[model samples]
Target: MEFVERYNGSGLLIEVEKILYEFKGVQHIQIFQTKSFGKMLVLDGKIQLTEKDESFYHEMLVHPAMLMHENPEKVLVIGGGDGGAVREVLKHDPKEVVMVEIDENVVKACKEYIGIDRGALEDPRVKVLFEDGLEFVKSCKDKFDVIIVDGTDPNPISQALISSEFYRDCAKICDYFVTQSQSPFAQPDYFKSIYKNARFKNKAVYLGFVPTYPHGLWSYLIASDRREIVLDLNVIKERFENRKIETVYYTPEVHISAFALPRWIVNLIS
Candidate 1:
């Protein structure tokens, strides 16, 4: 059986599948059927982004801040080339949504193939910039109400995005900073380093879990200059209950439940 797709100019490959329907949407984007990870979206057709259970990743990234802030207007998203993060951020109806995605191909593929992003690119309020996120943060003079760092794993290329310096830069440009820290179960050292770095730069540091990612669980770190790290569970629940938008995964109950970490896991961080 062929394991690779015919190469397309935009970095996409088409693959013939037996058990799973595999297709390369772009140079870095591969979609496949999987038993555990669900329909997986692989970058460079290599790293997995989502499975069938995508709501877990999307909800954990977006709702915590949406509920935490009284009202968020200017929102900045870094490295969310797939647009899943942007889709969730838009629920708040922010005045401006700026996405700094280093790879324009990822955004193009996601818009053309990924159903989850659901036309987030077409929103008039969104401004897409094809540039390095780290540089964008460094040069940004205006601060944002919320900044979500939806970056990939810490390979050499992504190392700067997860470094202490990056978090410091983010602190300067954002009121609230939320990022997908490496999964504690898979890359505890990486997560610890980022957590410690974030704690050193920002006042509030908190963690949340998403279940769809590798190890059937994932972690995210939240840092803010002024606000406490805890999500207002009551407020989030109320917002979900009153929400007019159709949602697949996030609810008031799920919002509160995701934050409930096991004592062992909490102790590991402490």
Candidate 2:
């Protein structure tokens, strides 16, 4: 049987297939779906977290920056309401992690249903701020060691967040900035526009790959003011090999390989 389960506040209606299983530990598991995406498993059967390959999305977003930065402290995550990004950031042992999510309902639903975050909300270093990310960055005086923008696609409402002005503010407040720059294969124009705007202010610009997103391949942009991202292949591989931390997705080889792209993609951006 099928039934409609409305996300309490977000107004996102998800159609549930069946009650899969319950995790007595933290969050329960249930399978569900929406029109845009296909079948998905909901933790506690409430939050819709992943459809097929969530690991690709989570890992690609988190690891590149964490491994790239020699030492990162004070991270600002904008729009990752699910807390997956926070969980990954904590692995680097940052002093503080602040997540600014526009919708509190997303956070509530994920915590209650999706167990993918692995209790990142409970971490002592994490501070979840339910507010607009654009506004939060405007008043932020302190610069961050790393800034990750894990936001949704640019719709009418999110246009401002992708605007040149917002990127300007990001440049002023962040030492190093990384954001989902859109799929180069699907959204080449959007990618070019964002890349051009970022280059105006940033000294270094780089792109990485993410599978399981739209177009079967996605892109992320990294920029810094003082430092150019020097991806030392040998150093990254060695570090991944020696990492004491447990990682399901990111390895040293994968970390270095993600940066490698096709010649056509390279030529387009170059």
Candidate 3:
């Protein structure tokens, strides 16, 4: 059967070529393909990633804050079972990468089907933990230089991850952090709330395009306890050159532009 997903009353319909895998775990996980997007991961009828443009989302989510950090040796990732984010983090050659995901099935399924991970989960620097992300962050005592929250939308099941308490817990563990905030074009109110709740020493919102997602636009909220973790185009360019990192969609120029929000959205959040 041809698969179709309606974007939660957004009046957008996404059609799939076939259902590669569909099963119940914490949520309904579906893997499928489309002519435009290659392979895709869908959870609870929401599009997560497409192989064609996954790098844009993953790199935008992981890199800017990571480059800002003087030395992000140890990292924590919450809810990125697909390992795309970890794959990007590994490029920085961090000493350790710990990923806490509630669903082992998603990890296994992605490992088997999604080529985006490129065997990142098996890399020596990564440690995958099957546990609730909220509890994991609260209980973890060891600190990290960077923490990435690659969580889904703030539904009933995952709402706690977007709460002020959860941000507090994250702040306790990392000097710098980033999260996959929803599209400011699609869910500006929700995005504003998440940004306001994250009362860090330094905070900024950056965006990238995710063609398969609701609006083809994704925003990430980056926060740092360190005041010097500001975005400077020249510094970011230098960092990229020093690391010799190659990316498909992210560049220092793009990084600088992503923060230039529309005046109304800025006022709304302000």
Candidate 4:
């Protein structure tokens, strides 16, 4: 029995039932099990997701942007090696889902261990590419209806994902964009930096709470070139009925509420 503490000292620790996997490639990756959070995925000492509440994180990360896109036929998922975002994207019945994961180990480990990713990678519409997401975006010519960046924390390995140039490249290729921005309470500067650098016609910040992550507050940024996010419950409900989409967390009401932020946090972004 052992305890793993988050890097930022959030005072939340997980008691490990056992170590399922560990590797040190681009960064340290560890998959373990806990009594509270169930199966845990940790990267660089940062808790990424837990099986118990993964639906909350994954649903929040993918659905808001997905629903806003009138027709999300083609989708791109960068750095979601665990396939949680891919699973959510497939719910929209996209024609294609291109997943670019920098580390292959994460995909391999999660495929065997993470329930959220089960059967997600094997879907006919999903094409997995093992490469650097930044380089892949730079050289790619195809455009997508939506792009979701389910990347790790902004460490050296993921620095390019947050760059102004990278966001510009993303804007050029996709109509709708979404990414897992860190918790505002923990990394306020980084959170503000993303909003500052993302050059999009329409943008909004939304949040979801996952107990396993730092600060228990997970933030996602949604950007678009053509569409303003539809916050109306009636419209969102209509879309859900049309698609017959089922999710554990995201709903029409939650979508509207997620964008409503605290005054202090809104001030930081503004």
Candidate 5:
């Protein structure tokens, strides 16, 4: 079988050996086995993560904000049903991580098949809540050092995650907020909407490469209540060294350079 992603006159097809799992619940979920990327998880026909290069997406999403914070003892992750973002956040030895996933079926599917989480779902420090992310953020009383929005693309149902109302609630509860902003190249409308709506005290859009994602590139928006969205390179390097965190794709240099967007992308934000 072949798994194909087609949109906007572009597509990616992967040769699949088997369909490991299929289900329809709050959202359609499918798992495919491919010799190249290992098992791939597709949620609502969009490639969420593949076993091989998921680090490129997850590490980029979780770490820059995690490291930018002086000490992220408490982290709140929204919509990371697969647990990949949670796994990366655990390396920081946070005191607690509150993971709010909307679909429990997605959580169960990834736990049994995807394996990207690597047991992050079962960590004692993690508290998994099955609820709508936007609603949860609005009702949450506890503050966090970092908040990671790991939701899906900017579709109609998921637009609330990237909305101004959501960012306002986030700003009240967290010092640093990071979110996947879709691919600036392949889905310019979605990315532009997110950047334009994010009216934080300070914000920056960082770059990363996710092969299976649209346009083979992805972007993330990091915002802070402080005047700075990112710390200095020297400070970042020093903090990263002190943490002694092991990562497959994230580095102090990468964290600093990711903010150096192309002129056009910068123009979109400005």
Candidate 6:
């Protein structure tokens, strides 16, 4: 019956029906009901996702790299405990999806209160592993067609994932790797670190809108040493039509346009 607010600079406040779950383990985690956004998930006092516009973030994070490849059969998802990233990956009908999440509590809380995941975690094609993502990437022997990192911001806990060491290992194992790179406008320096530290031969950054996150705009990076990810617009469009997937935000045009960086981002990354 009260409102919880996320304190950044100006911050965001949401009226909650009730706090469904809240705990302090490794980090603080909470899930609560909201009227406009449906249910919301918070991690370490940061708003992770709200039910209303999560599709924008999830679709953009998943589809661009996925379509960049011809047929991505084997995929890896790291740290998206809410399962939104996993759900998007399922649309392509990949042979297998290996998900490694650092926090099991986040998954459990999202599973119970927030249904944004739309039940993709239980899909037979997915294998869920609760472990440290950086360690998992270092040790994984299997090569994947695509690797998507849906982790938190680059803090001490997530710094290793955005580190050059992790990026090198990921490049060696996967044909393509994509990860959240923070908002281009809000955390430009941090975003630059994550985007630049990858050091891959062929890397590209894309932009999307995530209303619940800081600045209402977010950026993501796709990195690979295999070859340039650029494909013809027609080819991307054909893939979209052939897959017959229903998406809320990302389309072939949007996929092509995501790489059309804003001038500010162009300057930031340059």
- Judge candidate 4 against the unseen true structure and give its global Cα lDDT, from 0 to 1: 0.87
Clashing pairs in 6: none
Q: Model 2 off-target regions past 4 Å?
A: 1-52, 200-211, 238-243
- Backbone clashes under 3 angstroms, per model: 7, 2, 0, 0, 0, 0
TM-score of model number 5: 0.97
Error of 6 at 131 (Å): 0.9
User: Model 2 over residues 79-174: C-alpha lDDT tens digits?
Assistant: 887777888788778899999887666677667655557898889889889888888888889888888988766654345677777788888877
Off by over 4 Å in 1: 1-28, 33-39, 44-46, 200-212, 242-245
The candidates, ranked best first by TM-score, are: 5, 4, 6, 3, 1, 2
Better of 3 and 5 by lDDT: 5
lDDT of 6: 0.87
Give the whole-model CA lDDT for all candidates, comma-separated.
0.70, 0.67, 0.85, 0.87, 0.90, 0.87
Q: Compared with the true structure, what per-residue lDDT tens digits does model 1 show for residues 1-270?
A: 233322222222323343323344324455555445445566643444554557667777777776677678999999888888898998888899999988787777666556577888679999999888889888889889999988877765577887878888888777788888876766678777777778533443334445444455677777787666666668776665555545676676666666677776677678
Better of 1 and 3 by TM-score: 3
Report clash pairs, candidate 5. none
Off by over 4 Å in 6: 1-8
lDDT tens readout by residue for model 3, 1-270: 344555546644556777789889788899997766788898887778888888989999998988887678999999998999999998888999999998898998998888678989999888999998889888998999999999887876678888888998898889898999897778877788799888887788877888766678788999877645576888888888888888999998988888888787678687
Ranking 2 against 4 by TM-score, winner:
4
Locate the minimum summed-lDDT window of 10 residues in model 6: 2-11
Model 4, 206-229: lDDT tens per residue? 999987777688899999876676
Give the number of the best model, judged by TM-score.
Answer: 5
